[model samples]
Target: MDILILAILIATGTYMLNAKEQRKRIALLGSHLANYQIEKLMEALTDGYLRALGESTDERRQQIWSLLSTTEAQLTEQFSRFAADFAKEPEATTRVSRLAMAIPFAEKILPSFTFDMRKALAIHARGIAHVVQNTSHLAPKDRAFMMTAELFLMQHTCHWFCKSKTIATARMLARHQTPHEQLVASVSADTRKAYLTLIKGG
Candidate 1:
């Protein structure tokens, strides 16, 4: 009976600690996110991509693609700025554990299992900018697909920063019906190489 009571106390304490850590991460990300319309821009660009792809006539399709270019540039600019700003945060505030579950102070306790999220965000910034610039002469459809993958992958990292890796992966699958592996596979070769090199955790 005593053991059971002690176990319950430990569990409650741990839960509270985890929640506190998560809240800090959520607040930090939210404060920066409030300064820009990254989410809104992503939605706009995604929808515009679909519309551009759906247009049947060549002229209309071309026009839609041209129209979305501005949005693409805007998203790239905002995200790069966000990443740059976020990277300036202190290491203590940006350390994210790679473990499957969130544990308060685990990043410090297990440095091998943790990584600096600033690096991940930097990789994402470069990937996004590279894709959006469309300098490789990729077809409109290909560019859209690659950009979608880049955005999804970036979104995944944000979720991971705010929660456990397992939770983040589950949420990505639930919301976008996209597996993390698929997102990685769809990005450009340069983006894929850099991302995979930095993201060694499950």
Candidate 2:
């Protein structure tokens, strides 16, 4: 009877430890996936904005506007899914809240309204910075690298938002180097490649 009790206790302890470890892994994975989703959303928005800016015809611009609206709705759905996953983590929840605040205003601006591109870009950049700052507990190094890539994207988005969007302008923004890029370049080759792929939505 004593031996059986000890065996059961040992098994219970092992199972509890494994469960705890599994939770940690899930949380970490959720954080990374959230970052990836944010990158995809931002990339889609930036591309839409640039396309809209580049088009001389009102019909093409309206098409891009419609595309941006659809992308915003899709991103909002993705964010809700993320919030469900990260609901228990306060840091994650806070980061999600900050990121969410950036979406609605831009979406509410009608196609006929004179939109302030600078203001729209600022909202996203600010939210990204807030999220990056608040989410350091979950895979800090990876999050830091993601922050760098996001800021890099933000800078170029603003650059093109101000300048006339041409192939030359787009290529120039893509080619522009920042200190963040230099810093993140030293991350593991796989990590760097994944960051680029995520930002580019590939």
Candidate 3:
């Protein structure tokens, strides 16, 4: 009877260990899938923005505006889904890091475009930076919700700016100060903090 009990205990321990390993594998796969989806979404946005810039006429601008609107809708949907997934699996640090890396790329693309688009992109980038900095304090589920809301706002604003003809005039009338430069400085400060934390093994 003692031998049988020991055998049962060993089997139970093995089952638990196997379950833990399976969970880790599942988490890693989810993170990779999330990263891939985000990259695809960013590429689509970048392509749409570049196509808009390449167009030389107002009719082309309208077409580009439509494309941007559709892209924004898609981004909103994707962000919502990501938020849900993040909520379900709050321990996915790899997914969070992947999301954070996309912010800088988005920032780089923003400055390559026109004045109005650049400013709008800068605002969005700053908001994302804010989300990244604050996320450390948040429960993963809450962090995901916050990030999703910010992205949705950014997409909505992008669609509005792209579709509106008056934005060009507004861009002309607005102060020509370099907000993007200021945003970069701010982001660098946050990056420094992150680096320091990493070095300290925090």
**Most accurate candidate by TM-score:** 1
**TM-score ranking from best to worst?**
1, 3, 2
- Backbone clash count, each prediction separately: 0, 0, 0
Location of the lowest summed lDDT over 10 successive residues in candidate 1: 193-202
**Model 2 agreement with the true structure over 115-159: per-residue lDDT tens digits:** 333233333444354433443443433443444455454444333
TM agreement with the true structure for every prediction: 0.94, 0.32, 0.34
Tell me the whole-model lDDT of each prediction, alpha carbons only. Answer: 0.90, 0.45, 0.44
- Among these predicted structures, which one has the highest lDDT? 1
Per-candidate RMSD, Å: 1.6, 19.4, 19.3
Residue 145 in candidate 3, Cα distance off native in Å:
23
| Order of candidate numbers by lDDT, starting with the best | 1, 2, 3
The list of candidate 3 runs beyond 4 A from truth reads: 1-36, 90-202
Off by over 4 Å in 2: 1-36, 90-202
